[model samples]
Target chain A: MYEFEFVKPTTVADAVAALGEEEAQALGGGQTLIPTLKQRLAMPATLVSLTGIAEMKGVKAEGGTVTIGGGTTHGTVAKEAASAYPALAALASNIGDPAVRNRGTIGGSLANNDPSACYPAAALASGATIVTSSREIAADDYFQGMFTTALEDGEIVTAVRFPVPEKAAYIKFEQPASRFALVGVFVAKYADGVRVAVTGASEEGVFRWSEAEAALSANFSAAALEGLSVPADGMIGDLHGSKEYRAHLVGVLTKRAVAAA
Target chain B: MTKISMKVNGKEVSGEVEGRTLLVSFLRDTLGMTGTHVGCDTSQCGACVVHVDGAAVKSCTMLAMEAEGAEVATIEGQANADGTLSVVQQAFQDHHGLQCGFCTPGMVMSATALLKDNPKPSEAEIRHYLEGNICRCTGYHNIVKAILAASGQLEGAIAAE
Candidate 1:
């Protein structure tokens, strides 16, 4: 790990000021950032810790929406959001195991936007809004690609607002080692229409499947997607699975998610 | 360098450490509390589990300075005041839960937290809660037995001990 200055701020204003330093990075949960630092993949002049801000850590559910603070750990979300949004809570409960859930945060997960991450799927499928210190961006405009987002330099995410869906479910084929999604699908049914998001298989990162969304929006059943064929081109292929295999799993899991919902 | 102060096993301690120093190193090297083992450099292994602010967390993935002013409890603190084994520890012994004993501390810490949250968890719950802690020795059968026994859900074997 590289030598750097560590700064912990008790408020958002102080955190913003600390992050303004040259070559400084915002630290949340440190589940990913800490390991990145140890491997010398990231070398910043200062480490701005966001765990000290009391206001940015909790969950509130009311008025047809569930609002969660950016710094709230996965454990808190798993416990608190169970009654209101069981599918989202189950996704949080199953991420990385008990230890990793205690430290990893939703804001950090969405910001890092790993190709295999589960939160991005949930957010996009549910039409959750990503709230930053400056503006609120819809999930459609938030994710750009793998390990990337639309976040500007030094911008801090304060919270996320999720519109409560009539029904939603997330199902993933976990890569046993890291518990990350091999090809996860989240199906959300709203009053207006149904939204389907797929993660871990796309080279372009988490993306919405308009065909499945249209099919499920009309019928809302597994049989509605009987003959749809998802193209295998541009899908991620590695030691875990082949592109065609993942493409097949994508169709299978989407049906499973819709059936479960 | 960063100066951090925190409570470890009911004692207030302070240390000056580099920003890059992990909490596991601070506990093992700086404070000489070597009971928390580090099995993997990555965060996959749960060998370095510890309690921070009354919640179990992986110490290897957090910086030492992030634990400032927090309460931390390690494997060294799991014993009774008279030096006898804790119920979770005794159950492990009574059930022969360990063969290599490398993942015992992490398993115990995770079990303690799980029972605190859900005291009378079912068998499936115990297995789900231990998803992070890996035990290559006993194939996890005895470990699950020990955890169920520790929770007082088992009847014959652990009750006799």
Candidate 2:
């Protein structure tokens, strides 16, 4: 790893100020960034450690909304929030493994926005708000593409607020090597309507399958997704699964998720 | 450079390390606690698992400075002061849970923490909880058995001494 300056800021304000420096990255769990740096994929001049900042941790549910601190680990969310958000908790429980869940944070997962990540699908389906230091971004607008996000330089995602759904479920077909999703579906029913988000099978990145959503909205049932075919035009293709396979999986997992919901 | 002061194995230790220094490196190099091995540079392997403030975490995936003022427990701390092995450690040994033992320490630490939180976890729950700690040897059947035996809920099971 390249030599760099380290600053442990005790407050969010201080952490934000430190992050404003040229080529400084906020260290949240370090489940992703540290490995990237060690492999020479990222070379930041400084690292602003956010662990000392007390505010960026915990999970709270109130007023039909669930707010998770940006620094909250997947394991905590899985074990602690299992009763309130079963799908999200189950999704968290299945992430990488116990150690990964212990070290990987929800905010880091969102900011990094890996193409096969599970949290983005959950966020999009739950209609969560990505609250940052500058502004709040809707789940739809937050994700841009694979390993890409709408966050500008120095913009730190502080928390995520998910509106509690009447019912929700997330299901994924994981790639054996990395255990990332090959095709993941998150389904949620709000007071207004049902939302469905798909991850891990898009060349343009995470997207919603409106056809499946429309079908499920009309009647929430597994049979509703029987004939739906997600377009293969911009879906991702890899050795583990072809675009067609992923497209097919989108329907299957969507049906399974709706059934589970 | 970052000056990190934290509790390791119940002792408060302080050190000044580079920003890029991983918590595993800090524990092994600076603190001389080499029990927490680094199996994979990426966060895939659980060889470097440790407890940060009573929660199991991957030390390799975190920076040393991130653990400042936090309580950390490594495999070295699992044994009693009288040199008696921890219940999980004894379980692993008696059940022949490990062969090469590269992943044993981490496996034991993670399982210990799991049992602490959920004392009466079922067999499936034990397997699910240990998904992160991979072992190439023993096929994990014995590891699961060891954890179940250590939990002390199984009637007529001999304690791994």
- Please write out the lDDT profile of model 2 over residues A1-261, one tens digit for every residue: 898888888778888899999999887777778888889988889888776667888889888888998989898899778887888999998988877787788998999998899999999999899999789999989989888999988777789999989999999998866778999999998878889999999986788888888887888888887778888778888789888899889988998899899
Poorest 10 consecutive residues of model 2 chain B by lDDT?
A: B152-161
Q: Model 1, range A1-261, lDDT digits (tens) per residue?
A: 989989899998899898888999999999989889888999999999999999899999999899999999999999999988999998999899999999999999998999999999999999999999779999999999998899988888899999989999999999998899999999999999999999999999999999999998899999999999689998999999999999999999999998898
- Isolated chain B TM-score per model: 0.95, 0.94
Candidate 1 positional error at A176, Å = 0.4
Question: TM-score of every model?
Answer: 0.98, 0.95
The residue-by-residue lDDT of candidate 2 on B2-21, one tens digit each, is 67899998999999898778
How far in Å is the alpha carbon of A240 misplaced in model 2? 1.7
Please compute DockQ, using alpha carbons, for every candidate against the native two-chain complex: 0.87, 0.75
Stretches > 4 Å off in candidate 1: B156-161
TM-score, chain A only, candidate 2, equals: 0.97
Clashing pairs in 2: A203-A236
Q: Is the docking of candidate 1 incorrect, acceptable, medium or high quality?
A: high
